[model samples]
Target: MSPSPDTSTDTSADDVMEALVRSAFQVMGVMTRISAEHDLSLTQLRVLGILRDRRPRVTELATFLGLDKSTMSGLIDRAERRGLLKRGKNPHDKRVVDVYLTPAGHELEQRLTDEFRRDLAPVVDRLPHHQRVEFTRLFEPLLSPPLVIKPRVTPQR
Candidate 1:
C-alpha cells in the first residue's frame, strides 16, 4: 500500500529528500572541479584526505571508503606509484599493510585543503549569520566520535 501523504505543507517530504540528494550531487561537482584544478581524481583526493590525519590498514580504508578490497588495492597502487603514499607492514601485525603519506602527499593535501577552503568560504559567508552559526554547530557533531579513545601498546614496541 502507498504511504499516507504528509499533508504538512504544499511541499512533501519527498521533495525535501530529492532536494537534499541534488544538493549532494551539486556539492560533489563543485568539489570535483576544485580537485581537478590540482590535477587529482576524486578517489585520489579522498584517499589523501583520509591519510592526512592518520594511517589506516588497506582493509580498514576499504571498509571506511565503502570500496571492495581489490578496488582499494588498485587505488593504493596508483597512489603509491604517484609518490603520494607509502605502504609497509603494520608494526602491530605483519600481515596487515599500513599506508602512510609521503612528503609529496603532505604538500598535495595542503594545497587541496587551501583550495577547498577558499572555494567554500564565500558560499558559507553568504548565509545569514544565525544560519551560519547553526550550520556550524550542527555540522560539528556529525564529524565527532561518540566514544572515548583508549591508548594501545604493541608487543613489539
Candidate 2:
C-alpha cells in the first residue's frame, strides 16, 4: 500500500521560505553539474546570459553581478578568449564599452538550457500532480522577476 501524506508537517511561511532556499541550493547543484559538461564556469554562463539579453557596459555588468571591476574584467577576458563574447565600443558613446554574445556563446547557452531541462525532466515527471503544481507556484517568482528597481518617475513634491 502507498504511504499516506504527512499533513502534520508544518507549512508555515517561514518553513516555506526555508524549503525554497534549500530547493534553490539543489537547483544550483544541478546547474553546476550540467554546466560542467560545457567546460564553462557558472559566472561565465551568467555573463553570457546577460549579454544575450542586452549589451551592458563593463561597469554596469560588474554592478549587476556584484563583482569588483577587476574580477568581472577577468571573467570577460576569459570568455572573450573562448570566442563566446565580444567587447566593442558602444555605438552611442565611443568611450563606453559594451559586451555582447558571439554566435558560439548563443550556441553554448542553448546547449546549457537543454542540459538543465534534461536534468530536471526526470524528477519533474515523477512528481505528483499537486506537488508539481505547488513546485511551479513556488518557482515561478524566481524565474520571472529579474529586478525590482523603483519607478522611473517620481511624484511632484
Q: For candidate 1, lDDT tens digit of each residue in 60-111?
A: 8877777778988899999899899999999998998899899999998988
For candidate 2, list the clashing residue pairs, or say none. none
| Residues 53-88 of candidate 2: C-alpha lDDT, one tens digit per residue | 799999888877777789989999999899999999
TM-score, prediction 1: 0.74
Residue 57 miss distance in model 1 (angstroms): 0.6
lDDT for residue 59 in candidate 2, whole number 0-100: 89
The parts of candidate 2 lying over 4 Å away from their true place are 1-11, 126-157
Q: What is the alpha-carbon lDDT for the whole of candidate 2?
A: 0.82
lDDT of 1: 0.82
User: Stretches of candidate 1 above 4 Å error?
Assistant: 1-19, 128-130, 141-157
